[model samples]
Target: MTASRLPQFSGKTGRPELMVILGSTLTVIAILGIVTFLLIREHAGAKETATRSATTIAQLIDADVLRTVELYDMTLQGLIAAAQRDDLRQVSPQIRHLVLFDRSTTARFKGDILLLDKHGEVLADSSLIEPRPGNFADRDYFQAHVTNTGSGMYISRPFKPRCDCEDSNEWRISFSRRIASSTGEFLGVAVASMRLTYFDQLFNSLYIGSDSTLNIIDDAGILLAQKPYLEHDSIGKSFATRPNVVRILREGSGSFESVSSIDGRQRLYTFSRVGNLPLTVIVALSGNDVFAAWRRTALVISGATGVLCIGLLWLSWLLCRELRLRHQAEQELAQLAATDSLTGVANRRILDLTLRHEWFRAQRSGQPLSVLMIDADHFKAFNDRHGHQGGDEALRTIAKVIAANVRRPADLVARYGGEEFSVILAETDSTGARQIAEKIRMAVQQLPKTEGDELPMTVSIGISTWTTQTDVTLEQLLFAADKALYQAKEQGRNRVVAGS
Candidate 1:
C-alpha cells in the first residue's frame, strides 16, 4: 500500500523586492565608480595632450622668432662691418640708404633696422627717408645691449615703435645687439624691429578650440603678444602680481588647471618657456571643451546601465512569479495524489498511511484505534441491472453518507477500490467503532435509488479495534477487518460485524 503525502511549506513572506533593490543599488554604485574613473582618466589624458601641443607650439614660435631676429642681426652685422671694414662713413648717402632699407621696406614682416649711439641717440633708421631724432636710452633693448655689449641678441617687450611711421602702425618688438670697436669699446646699439603680426599670424593656421587661448608672456610677467589678436590690447600689462604668473615663473614648463585672470573661466593651462628667451607660452583650454567627449560617453553608459537595471528587475519579478506558481502547482499535485479521483475522499493510499500511524499512536498512549471496512452489497448485480454509470452514482452517494457518519477530526473515510471503502478512527474503541459503522449502514440504506432497475441500496461494514493488550500488526488489523467484511457478505449484508 502507498503512504500518505501532505506537502508542507513555511508560511513566512519572501523579500524579492528588497533583494532586487539591493542588487540594483550595488550595480548603480559600481557603474558610478567606473564612470568617475573614466572621467578622471580622460581629463588627465586631455591635459597631457594640451601640454605637449602648447610646448611644441611655444618652441616653434621661439625658433621662428630666433631665426627672424638672427637674419636681421646679420644685416646689422653687415652695417657694423661696413663701418669698420669698408669705411661706410665714406660711402655715398644714397647707396648706403638703398643698401640698408631695401628689404625692410619690401618685406611683409616689416623688419626695420636702426643704429643707436652710446648715449642711446638714434644714428640711423631703415624705414625712414632720414634718421629720425629720437632718444632710445630708456628702451630695454638699447639699454641691454649698451650695458652688456653681448654677442647674443636681446629681445624687448612688444610695444609701439618709438618713431614716426608712415606705413602700417602696428605694434612691434625690438631685437638688439651691441656694436663694439676692435678694442672692445661699445660704440652703438644695432637693432632690428619685428611687428607683432608675425606671432599673431602663426596662430591663425591652428584650430585649437572655440574657448582656447594662446599667450606669450616674458619671464618678468610682461604681456608680449596673444591670439586671437586683442584690440586696444593689454600688451604692456605686467602679470607680476597675478597668481598664475607666479606659478608660471616657478615652473619652466608644465600643465595645470586654474581660473583665467582675464575672463574668470576655469581652464586647463599648458605652459612652457620659449627657448631660453624668458618668454612663456600658455595655452588655455576651457574645462567644457576638455571634458566634452567624456561626458558624452558617460551619458551613453548611464543610459545603457539604466536599461540593464530595468531588465534585471524584470527578471527578478518573473522569477518570483514563477516560484509562487510552482508552489501552488506542487500543493495541488500533492492533494490530488492523496485524494480519490472518483469520490473526492482520501484514497486507499491515505487510508493505509493513517491506519499505520494511528496504530503506533494508540499503542503509545494505551488508547484504542478502530478501522471500518465498508462495501456496497450486490454492487456487481446493481451495475448489471442499472448500468455502470448508475453504479458510479450509487458509490458516490454511499461514500458521501459514510463520510457524514465519521464526524471526528481524527476520523478519515477513504475509497479502497470499486465499491469498497474504509474508515480510520483514532482513539476510538470497539463500541464507538460499532456505533459509527451502524450509523454508516443505516445512512447508506436510506439513499434514494436514481435508476429504475437499480437494486436496493445497502452497505456491509467490518469493524476492527486495537488496544494496548492487543498485540496486532497494522497489516493483521487490516486483514482481520477484511475477513469480517467477507463474512458479513456471506451472511446477510447491510449489517456490522466486529473482527477479533
Candidate 2:
C-alpha cells in the first residue's frame, strides 16, 4: 500500500493558476474596498446636507416665534401704561375725534383693544363683549399672571371661547402680562387673544418642502399649534407616546429616520430645542429627497464597481471564478444571520448585542432607564378574523406606527414576539413612561381599522421605570411591563397601565 500511494495534486511554486487566483482575489477585495469607501463618503455627505437644512429652518422659525413673543410684550406694556394713568378712557375716543376733525384722515383702527384687571377680569374693553367688565377672571392666562410674578410676558395655551355675538365662533390663542403699579404691586393682567386661524395661516406659509410640517408643543408636550389645524381633543393631546419627540425634549436635540406622522412617507428628521422655552422645532426631509445626490453617486459607483469586477474576472477567467462565488456566499450568510426575516427588524441576536451595549452606557452615565411592553389587544382574534396574511399586515402597520412615534436616537422599537412589541425608553421616569403609554394608546386608536371589525384595533401597554436604587435586572423590568400589559387587558383593552 505504501508503495502504491497516488501522487498529490500540489502545484509547482510558480504555477500560473495559483498566481491568477491570488491576483483575482486581491483585485476583488480592492474593488469592494473602493466601493465601500465611496458609499461611506456618500452617506456622510447626505447627513451633512440634512443637518444644514434643518439648522437653517430651525433658526428661521425660532426668529419668527421670538418676534411674536416680543410683539406681545410691547402690546401689553402699552396697555399697562394707559391703564395706570387712567388715560385709556381719555385717549381712544379723544384721539378718534381729533383725527376725524383733521379732515385728512381716511384710516380707522380695525382691531378691538381691551384692558384686563389683575385677575384677568376685563375692566374696560373697546369692543364691548357682553359679561365683559369682569369676565376673564378664571382664564389660565390671567391666573398665570396673578400667580407667577416672574412671568414677564406669557402666551396662553390655545382655547375655544364662547362668542358674545351668538352666531360667531371664535377660537383664540391669548397673550397676557401682569400689570404692576408704581410700587411694583400687581394691578391686573392685560390680555389679547388673537384668533388661531390667523396663526395657522402664518405657520402654513413657512413651508420647507412638500411634506414638511411645523408643530408647536407646550412645556407639557401638548400640541398648542400646528400648521393645518386639527380639532378639539386633537389640539391639546400629548405626544408623549412619540418616543422621538420625547427624546428630543429630554435630550435637547437629535436626528433619526422614520415614517412621517402626516404623510406616512419615510423621512430623515432633525429636531432642535428652543432655548429657554419648552418648545422643540422639528424639520423633516424625505429620505429620497435628502439623499438623492448620494443615491445617484452610489449608482455611479456601483456601475464602476461592476465594470471593474468584470474586467478582473475576464483577466482571470481560467482560475478565479470559484473563489468569487465562495466569497459572495459568505457575505449572504452573514447578512442573513444579522437580519430578522419575519419583521425585517434586527433579529434577537442583534437585540442582545444592543441590550448589552445600552446597559453599560446607562451604568456609566447614571441615568434613569425605562422599558415598555406593548401587546396588541385581541391579536389572536385578529388572526382568527383576517387570517395569517392579515395578521402580518397588522403587525407591520403597528411597527410603522411605533417607529413613527419614537423620539430619540437611542430609543429602540422591536418586535418582541408574535403579537408583542417592546421599546426602550432611556432616561425616563415613571410619570414620563405613563404619559408615553397613553400616547401609544391614542396613536393606535387613530389608525384606520379595516371594515366589518366589531372592535377597533388597539394595544395594551405596560411600562416600568428603572433607577440605580432599584437593583432590578433588565429581565425583571421586562417582566414588570408584561404583568402591566396583562393588567391593562384585564381592566379592558386599548389602554396603558404602569407597573410598580
Candidate 3:
C-alpha cells in the first residue's frame, strides 16, 4: 500500500461534469427567462383588451339609454301640449285612428296611447276600460309629475297596472308632464305608460355572447326591464337595498360586478345614465365569459412556464446548480407578493393600488364616484348561535354571493374588516346609489339563514356619493358610506340607506 499512493479526486474539478452542469443550467435559465417575459407580455395585453372592450360596451349602452329617454321626453311634451289645450278628446281620436289606419306610428311606437287627468285618472285610453273612471292619484309617477315645474321631464319606475289586463300583470315605464290650464295654472298630468316588454325586446336585440345581459332600472333603482325576465320581488323593488347598484347610481355611471339577483350568476357590469333623465341602462356579461379568452391564454402561458421550469431544473443539475436555485427562489417570491393568501381575491394592498388608478381615470372623465359600506347583520349573533366554524362557513358563503353580484370589471368588492365589505361604484348619483343598496339587501335575504338564530342574518348597507367637490379620496367615500350604514342600522336592520 505504501508503494502505490495514487492522487485523490476532489470531485469539484471534472471538466466534463463542470461543462455539462454549466450548459444545462444556462439553457434552463434562458428558457425560463423567455417564458416569463412572454407571460408578462400576454397578461398585460389581455388586461388592456378587456378594459377597452368594457369601456366600448359602456359607451354604446349609455348612448342608447339617453336616446330612449330623449324620445320619451319628446312624447311627454307632445302629450302635455295636447292636454293643456283640453283637446285630449281630439288628440286621443287621432292617436287611435292612426293606430287603426296608419301602419307607420303603430309599428314604431308600439303601445296603446293613454290620457290621464291631474291625479293620474284615466280620461281616455286606447285600451278601453269599463266606465273609464279609475284614479291613479296615489301613484308615485303622478305625484312626481305634478310637482316637477322645472323644464326637466319626469320618468316613473316600472309599475303594474291597477286595471286588469288581458295580458298578465305587466310592468310599465311611464313618462308624465304637468297639464296646465289656459291661465297657465297646473291642472293635471298627461302621462304615457309604455310596456316594459318593449324595452325587454330592445335590450334583447343587443347580443354579446350567451352570458351577456342588459337591464334598465329607474332612478329609484327598481328594475324596469331585463332580458329573460326572472320573476322575483326584485323586479319592482327599490334598488337602494342593493349595495352594488347603490354604488353605481351614486357614481352616476361606470362598471362593477355583483351576483345577479335573478339567477345568482356572477357578472361584470357597465352602466350609463340617460342624459337628462333619472334612468340607468346597465349591461352585464359574466366575467368568466368575458375573460375566457384571456384565461385560455394564461393556461397556455402557465403550461409553457412549467416546461421552462423543468428545463431550468435539468440545466441547473448540469450547470451552476447554486445560481439556478437562487434565481428560481426569487421568481417564486415575486409571485407570492402579488397573490392573496385568503379568499384568493385581490388583497387590500392590490385594492389600494387599483383605487388610485381608477380614481385618476374617473377624475379625467368627470364622473361621480361612490362607495358602499356593507356589514353583516347580527353576525356575532350568528356566531353565538352556531360555533366559530359555522360562522366561518357563513362568511365564506356571503362573500361568494357578494362577489357574484358585482356587475362590472372595474368595480371592486373587498372584505374591509371582519363581517364588513366595501364596494366601489363609479359614475353614479344619489338616487342610483340607494337602489343598489336595496338590491343587495334582497340578494342577502335569498341566502340561507342560520338555523335557530333569534333573527335572520342580513346585511346593512350605507352608500355615499362623490363628486368633484368631494375630490377623489377613497377615505372620504368610505366615511360617507360608513355614515350611511350607521343610518341604515339605526333605521332598521337589513336595509339600505344613503348618505348626504
Best by lDDT: 1
Compared with the true structure, all predictions reach lDDT values of 0.76, 0.68, 0.67
In angstroms, what RMSD does candidate 1 have relative to the true structure? 10.8
State the lDDT at 22 in candidate 2.
77
Candidate 2: clashing residue pairs, number: 9
Checking candidate 1 for backbone clashes, the offending pairs are: none
Q: How displaced is residue 450 in candidate 3, in Å?
A: 94
User: Total clashes, candidate 3?
Assistant: 50
Q: Return model 3's CA RMSD, one decimal.
A: 40.1
Cα lDDT tens digits, model 2, 359-478, are: 667788878777788889888988998999998988877776776677666666666778888777778878887887788778888889777696678998998877888888877877
| lDDT (Cα, tens digit) per residue for candidate 3, span 231-278 | 655577776767777877888877666887667887777777766567
Per-residue lDDT of candidate 1, residues 401-497 (tens digit): 8877877767788899999999888898899999989988988787776557454599998988888888888888889899889889988998999
Give the CA lDDT, 0 to 100, for residue 404 in model 1: 76
Runs off by more than 4 Å, candidate 3: 1-41, 54-65, 86-112, 127-131, 181-184, 229-233, 256-266, 320-500
Alpha carbon lDDT of residue 70, candidate 3? Answer: 63
Q: Weakest 10 consecutive residues, lDDT, candidate 3?
A: 1-10
Best-to-worst ranking by lDDT:
1, 2, 3
Of 1 and 3, the candidate ranking higher by lDDT:
1
